[model samples]
Each structure stands twice: as structure tokens, then as C-alpha cells.
Target: MAADITPLIHRVRRWPRRVVITIAVVAVTLLAVRIALPYVVRNQVNHRLQSIPGYTGHVADIGIALWRGAYALEGVEIYKVSGEVRTPFVRARTIDFSVAWRDLFHGKIVSDILVEEGQLTFVAGATEAESQTDVDRRWQEVIEDLFPLEITHLEVNHGLLRYQDTTKTPAVDLFVTNLRLAATGLRNRPSESGEEFPAEIVLEGDSLGGGQLRLAISAEPLAAQPHFHLSAKLENVNLPELNESLKAYANVDVSRGKMELAAEMAGKDGGFQGYVKPFFEEVDFNNVSDENKSVLTRIWENVVQGLAWLVKNKARDQVGTRIPFQGRFGDPQVGLWTTIVNLFRHGFVRAFNPTIEGTVDPDNVLPTGDSADGEGVASEKPETPPKVATDDVKKVEPEAAAPTDQPSKKRTP
Candidate 1:
């Protein structure tokens, strides 16, 4: 037994060197992989981007996160090489693609995408060569190739949506800045409401004239036909700041005023219903100089000013009209007489409410029949619930705004 103890001591001494060598080899392998992963991803992404038909794209850098199973792309830019427009079509400061943990918990595998400081520009001109609308590009294919997982969540922060018209006298450049958007539940996951239309999207931005723009949509993205509920609102827009665009398009100019607009649209089974309500407060067109003005132009301006003055609500000092329509998607019919009557009704009767009227509900609309046959059935506001003084009845206010109908001022930092 004493002789065997000497052999055991030698074996124990050799074990430490073997373990050290094994650890050193693993450490070197992992270090090499960590350095190489980003290079491989960068090359693959750039190749996919350039494969799009009419666009050229490049990525400045790529970063990998092994623990989270995510990657980030920096300085991604896509340009239209075929168009006369010099500005890039799409540009992003950073884009992150990662696993959607919330959906994963629900037994669904999907991906989440976040884009920061992104810009999408559109150029309008007379010919096809002058316009850069991305109509000819297969950008969706590129996105599908880069990320193999199904996208369930998307977010954009501090974005810009820009439009440029070169055909006009003084090239029109309009943009919405500080834009934020979120789209979730694209794959129709289960929800508390258990509604058929589960996908929800929200968009908010600041327009060129200091207007706050907000839009919300609830949709069934995988439906056979388009089905959705949408509400949009733009408020406190200075009218004079948009004179160039107005004068170019409408042949009208406003010296002073602020405008607020609200609308609701619902589409289901190839049919739709909606109304657009516009409010103008303290608008004026009479301050124009008489020089270089034709007689017809002067008469037209005076007529426009008189009509607004005549129909404006005295209490609110706002002129507004609700133009309602409902019909098949292929051919829509506007309620011309209803629009004319609303003008008088808005001024003589109660003023049109400067808020979203939750009258358009896709579930309430008839999919087929007179309602969907372009018969011009007017959408009605929810009736006020009868008040019961007794304790047995609970009072419900139908006019109360829903959370989705209210314009949110939330901005991403």
C-alpha cells in the first residue's frame, strides 16, 4: 500500500496541466468566433440589400449579442440608382432584430424589430424616371431573406416621413418629424378581448406646420380581404404655414387660422364606411394684396371668405362639415346632399364636435346587402342611454371617447 501512494501522487500532479490546456483551447476558439461573427453578418446583410432590383444598399457595421440571440445593424442606407432623385430612399441610424420573448412565452416563435432615426423619402415628378417611390423595388423580399423568423412586433423611433414634389414652381418639400410607430400582434395571438381583429398599430408625428398627427388601426392582417378599423386626427395646424402647398393644389391661400381634422374609417369584406370632419378656426382670405390679381380670383376669394363666415359656429368660432360615405371598395359614393346640408346644420344647429365620432365599427356593418351595395347608408352616432333615477339601472355614457379614439401625444425619447 505505501508503494502505490507514490504512483497516485504523480497522477494527481499531471491532471492540472491537462485541465489548463483544455481551458486554453476553448478560450481561444470562443474569442475567434466572437470576432468573426459580425463580419459574416455584415457581408450577408449587404448582399441581400443589394440584391433588390433597382436599389443599392450598404451597411457600415454590424454587432452581435450571443446571450440575447440578437444583432444590430448600424448606418443602413438604401438608394434608388435608377431615379433622378439624389436623396436616399431609406436610411436608418440603427436597426435591432431580436427574438420576441413575449410571443415566445405564448408558444409562438417570432421576431421583434426596432428602428431608430429612420427616414423614408418619396419624390414626385412628371415622369417615371423622375419619381422615386420604391414601386419597382422588392424590399419586402430583402427583409424576409435577412430575418427568417415571422415578425410579430415592430417599432420606429424618431423617424421622418418626407415628400418632395419637383414639378411645382418652388419645389414642395413637406415632412413629418419626430415620428413614432408601433405595430404588434401581426400573427393574431390570443388577447383579453378575444376579438377576431387582433393586430393593432399606432402612429404619431409632428407635421411641418406644428400640427400633431395621430392614427390608430386595428386590423386582421391575414384576412382574405382587407378588414380594419382606423381613426386619425390632426390638430392645431397653422394654416398660413402651408400656403405654398395649398396655393399649388387648391388655388387658395389663407392669411391666418388653425385647422383640426378628424376621421374614422372601417372596412370589412370588400366594403367600407367612413366620414371626414374638418374644423377651421379664425380663417381669413381677405388680407391678400389687390396687385397682380385677376377679377375672377378676387371674386373667388371673397366668395370663399363669405361662405366660411356664414356657416361658422358662433360659440366655437369654427366652421366644419362631416362628409360621410359608405360603399364597395371598387366604387365609393360620396353623400353630396348630406355634405351640403351638414354645412347649414353645422352653423345653425349645434356645432360639429371637434372629436372623433366612434360611429364606424366594422362589426356593426353588414358585409353583404344594401349596406355593402353602395346604397349610401349614413353612419349614425351612438344613442345616449336613457337616464334612470332608480338604483336598479347603471348609467352608461355612449358619447364618452374610447382610448383608441383619443389622440395620444406620447413621443419616444
Candidate 2:
């Protein structure tokens, strides 16, 4: 028995040596794959992106932990238009997200998306030029095709946005920064009757021109003409800090001024309506800084600024206001005071008239774009809080694209 036991022990010890060596080979192989994973992911992502209909851009680096059910992206840049650009239209510092473990094994991809420290730029006049490099495709459709995955939740932290239109006089470079946004129920499909719409969304941020911004929008985009309701507030907008944007877009600059704005618009069926009222609490316009501007433009700005100070409503310590609005979404019949007070003091006198590029389209649901070609118009009720409201959206065409119910690269300005 002793002799048999000794031989068995020897064989057992030698067998362990082979097992240890096999285990070591596997460990090294896994480590190698893990180290090489980022490169593989980067190449695959770039290849997929380049294959998009009209998009050509790349992801810089990726951090992957597939077993942990998550991945992250470091730098992402996509051109505003086709070909190389001095500044890419979209850039993100970190984009991290996770997928459901159950979904992965089933071969179905679903994810909760998060984006951090990103910027979206809209260059107003990019079209399919004569150059072969430039290709124009429907932005919303392109996005839907690229990210066909199901999304249940999303968050955006510290996002920056810019709207630039160099066609203007001083060139418009409007910015909104420090944006934090969240949403759910974004990808719901409609029933046979119609789609349940206006996915709840909350957005808060600071305007680079000096103001706190808040927006609540309910969006349901599956319909031919999407339905939505949006309420926006711009508080304590500093007039002086907006010199470049104001001077370029509206032909005015200020030394010291402050304004608060409240707007609630709802659209349904094919039209929309709402009221936009600007409250100027304390405003003092100083001067213009156009060394090479036209004589008429310079003189006009100075004259308007002077008139504002002289005739500003003293009782309220403000320049008088009016809630002027119009619409293709439906005429809520917003009131514009035609009284003598408005003639002397109003938003028009102090430059709060919202326009698209150079064309004034009161029908614009959010004071951001142009009139729509849809059949219906919008109107506002007499007294309603910023509760759930509805608006309709058709494509803004070259002006700006329509935003989807989710947060993604296809976000429109």
C-alpha cells in the first residue's frame, strides 16, 4: 500500500504542472485580448461611422469592460458639413454608457446613454455644395439608422452648444453652456389611433451671454408631423455680455442692461401658438462699436439707444413690454399693445424681437427658426400655466433640424 500511494502522489504532482501551464496560457491570452480590445473597438467604430450615408468622422479612444456591461468614449468629433473642417460640429469629452447583461446574450443591443462635456455646433448655411466631398442627407434619418438600438434612459451633463451664422453683419456666435439634461420614455411608438407624445424632458443651463435657461419639452416624433409642447424661461439676461451676438444679429450693443423672458407655446394637429413677453427691469444702452459699419447702421443704433433711455417707463423702472406672437400652429391670438406707451417703449425699441437669421417669423414655436409650410396655425389660451402643452413640428429645412425625443448626435439646434 505504501509503494502504491507513493507512485500516485508523484503522478498527481506532475499533473498539476501541466494544469498550471495551461492556466497560465489562458490568462495570458485573455490579457492580450483585453489589451488589444480598445484598438479593435476604435477601428470598428470608425469603420461604421465612415460608412454612414453622409457622415465622415471618427472616435478617438474607447475604454471597454464588456464583462462589466459598459464602455466609454474619450474624444468624438464629427464634421458640421462634409469633408475636413477647422472645428468639427460635434465634440465630446467623455461618453459613457451601459447595456443590460440579459440583452447582450440574446444578441439584442439596448443601452442607457450618458454624455458628458460635449458641444454641438450648428453652422447655419451648410449645403451640398458643388464639391464632391460635401454630401447632404436628412440628419434625423441618418441618426436613426446609425443608432437603431433601443434606448430606455439618457442623460447629458455639462453640454455646450453654439449657433453660428457668418452671413450676418458681425457674424453670429451664440452659445449656451453648462447644460444638464435628462429624459425618459423617449422612443415610444404610436398606437394605431395615434402616438402618445411629448416625452417628458427637463433642461437647465446657462447662456454664455449671461442668463439662466430652463426648458421643459414633451415630444412625440413618430407622427408625420411630430407633436410636442415646450416651455422656456430666460432669466436675467445681461445685455452687455451679449455685445458680439447682439451687435451681429440685431445691430445693437449695450453698456448695462438686464432682461427676463417668459414664453409658453403649444402646438397640435398642424399649427402652434404661444406668447413671448420680454420684461426689461433695468436697461441702459451705451453705444455701438462698429468702426467700419455703414453710416446708416451706426447712426440708427445710436439713435435707438438714446431713445430707449429717454422714454423708458419710469413708473415700472422698465422699458414697456408687449406679448406679441403669431403662428402657423394656430393663432392663440396673443396681444400686442398698440397703445401710445408701446409706441415709445417696447421690445422692438430695445431689440428683443426674435427673428430667424434676418427674417422675422412669429410662427416660430421657440424663437429659434423660420416659419413652417404646414397647413395649420397655433394659438394660446387666455390663462394656462406651463403644464403639458402640445405643438407640431415640420422640418426646419436648412435653418435647423428637428430634435428627436432622445439625446443623441442628431440633436438639432
Candidate 3:
């Protein structure tokens, strides 16, 4: 019985040894494939890139590497020649991408594109400008021709954005830092009828002091129309710094308070309608710069001064005097009058038009009264005659007749 059990144990042991050997062989094979995969994939990538009509230069230094079941890429550069391909839109910098071989083999491309370090530039009018209808048709064609592909992850670090207006000589530069983004279901083709891969983008920067901003966006792409709906919120922005960033614009400055905004937009073919609600606290117009002050002054003189004068006169009549009123120094057309009125109601002005009719305190610092120190002179109201009592009229009538009878003898002057 012991010998028979030994035979069964040997059979089981033999099966375990075969399993180990098979695993070892498979491991060696995987190792060899990993070592050779980079070269093969790199060559394939080079050939595919060169085949594009506009590809000019290509260089791949470090090959692909697979470690821990993930693919890694290094040392890749590509340059754009001239091309008629319209898929990615503009033909600028077509190279400078590194990706995992597995992603490419799986028909999905996942890579971190270093756009900030690359020299990517765009010439907007290089292609002929078309009418809105034509543009829409072209966009529809492009969307229909798009192929399905996946992008697991994407990141842009320390990116630089520069724009040159068609007439401007110098380009405006902006820097974006620590931009981390991730996405899923990013396909060139629409998933469902109007489905798109959901995406979340986060951006942060300290270029403006105490003016950091974070924005989040999510959108779904539409079929045929290639439309997208997006929502974004900007937080913790110092409006003063933002205004300074817009110094290139002629007469613009943030007067007072920071700003936070939230908005949503959806459409296609460069047409969209959106509402932005901006919240401001402790906002004032007197804090604006000189240039902006001039603009504000002109607007006030033309559009608001007449209204203000009327208010000042009415207030004087109610208070029986002219009170000291500080007029706002911002664009009156943009609800500055309402702000001033609110400030007046807040006791900043000595006299303001109150809902309750008739007379304000003359001693109020606003336009109602003259100052005790003679610093301000109050406007005087017209005098009104005193009213006589109706009953006292009869008492004076008899005295009037007696005076007439005596007057006949008293005329001996």
C-alpha cells in the first residue's frame, strides 16, 4: 500500500514540474519580446510618420520599453513639412510625441504631449476662409471621416500660449503651469448618436499674485454637427491682475473687488449663446486707473451727469439744502448709477432720495444741509407767505368800517 501511494505522489509531482518548466519558457519568451518590441515599434512608427504627406523630419533615439506590463517611450522628435491633410486641422508641429507600444498596438494612443517645450505655431488664414454654411459642411465631412481611437491619458506641463493678432506686431504670451488632464472614451468617431468620451481638465497657475484660478470642463461631442457642450467655473481670481493682463486694450482697468465667474456654452460652427454671472464684493469705481477714469468721466458727462444733477436737485429740495455727494467715477452706462444709489443708501452720502416723501434731515452730510463749519453752503428754499385764520377775517371787518368813518374827520392834514 505504501508503494502504491508513492507512485500516485510521483505522478502529481511530475505534473507540477511540467507546469514550472512551461512557466519558465513563457517568461523567457516574454522577456525576449519585451527587449525587441521597442525597435520594431519604433521602426513602424517612423515609417507611418514618414508616409504622411507633410512629415519632414523624424528621429527616435531611445526605443520603446515594456516593463511591468506597460509600454514606455523615449527620445522622439517629428517635424512638419507641408501637407494637405485636414484631420488635425492646422499643419504646424506634427512630431514630438512619445507613446507606449501597447497603446499603439491596441489601436489606442496614450501619450503625454509636451506642447510647451515644442515650437508649435499656427497660421490661421493659411486655408481659405469659407462662409459659415460651407464651414459647417466641411466640419461635418471631417467628423464623418473621423476614425475611432482611444486616448487613455494626456498631460501638458508648463505650457506656453502665444497669440499674434492679424495686425499686431508683438505676440501676446501666456504661461500655463501644472496642467493635469485625464480622459476616457476619446474616440475620433462618435460613440452613440451624440455620445462623446467624457473628459475632465484641470488647470492651475500663480502667474497673478493671489490670483490663482482653477477651471473644470466636461463635454460630449455630437454626431454630424460635431458640436460640444461645455461648462466652466473660474475661482479665486484677482480681478485687478486680470485687468492688468489686458493692458494692451486702451482704457480698461478693474476698479475694485475680485471676480468669480461661471458659464456654459454649447453649439457648432462658431455660434453659441451663453450667460456669465460675475460676482463682485466691495466694488467701487474710484479705484480705477487714470486712463479708465477718463473713459468713465466721458461716459458720465455724456450719459449720467444730467441724471445725477436731477437727483442732486431733488435731494436738495427734500433736505432744504445741498449736501456733499460724491459721484461715482466709472462707466455709468454699466449700472454705475445703481451702485452709487446703493452706496448712498448705505450712508456714504449725507442725503439721498428716500422712498418716503418730504424732507430729509438738513444736518445730513449728504446734499441736505449746510455744514456748521461753513465748508458747504446749503441751497435755500423759496419763502411761503403765512396763512391767516378764516375766523379772524370777521373780527377785522368792523374795525375796517370804523376806521373809514373816522377817516372823514381825520383828513384835516
How much lDDT does candidate 3 score? 0.35
- Tell me how far the alpha carbon of residue 100 in candidate 3 is from the true structure, in angstroms, after superposition: 12
Local error of candidate 1 at 375, Å? 7.2
- In Å, residue 65's CA in model 3 sits off its true spot by 3.9
Distance from true position, residue 104, model 3, in Å? 15
lDDT string, candidate 3, 97-137, tens digits: 34546666877554433232222233332343310002234
Q: Write the per-residue lDDT of candidate 2 for residues 1-413, one digit (tens) a residue.
A: 89979988887677867797997899999999999998997887677667765456688899897876777877877763454345666678777777755657888566677887777776654434312233344544444443555665678777777666655766666676667777765563543345455366777766754687777677675645536666677777777766777766667666677877666655545555545656665765545344566877777777876676666666656664435444444334444543334536543354333211112222344322223543212221234233542222221112122222213221111
- For model 2, the local distance difference test gives 0.59
Compared with the true structure, what per-residue lDDT tens digits does model 1 show for residues 1-413? 88979898787677888797888899999999899999999999998888788788999999898787799999989988777777888988889999988778899678999888778889998887788886532665688787778888888877788898988855677777777788877763444566677787877777867897877878887776678878788888888777767656756678788999887778888777778888889888865643676888678778888888899887877889889877777677788888878888889986777667665667655654125333333544552211111112221112222222112233111
Per TM-score, the best of the predicted structures is 1
RMSD of 3: 28.6
Best by lDDT: 1
Off by over 4 Å in 1: 1-26, 102-107, 134-137, 167-170, 188-194, 288-299, 326-332, 364-380, 383-413
Could you tell me the C-alpha RMSD of candidate 2 in Å?
9.9
Query: Candidate 3, which segments miss by more than 4 Å at Cα?
Result: 1-37, 46-63, 67-69, 75-149, 152-170, 188-210, 239-245, 251-259, 268-271, 277-413
Choose 1 or 2, whichever is better by TM-score.
Answer: 1
TM-scores for candidates 1 onward, in order: 0.79, 0.68, 0.41
**Local error of candidate 1 at 311, Å?**
2.8
**Sort order, lDDT high to low:** 1, 2, 3
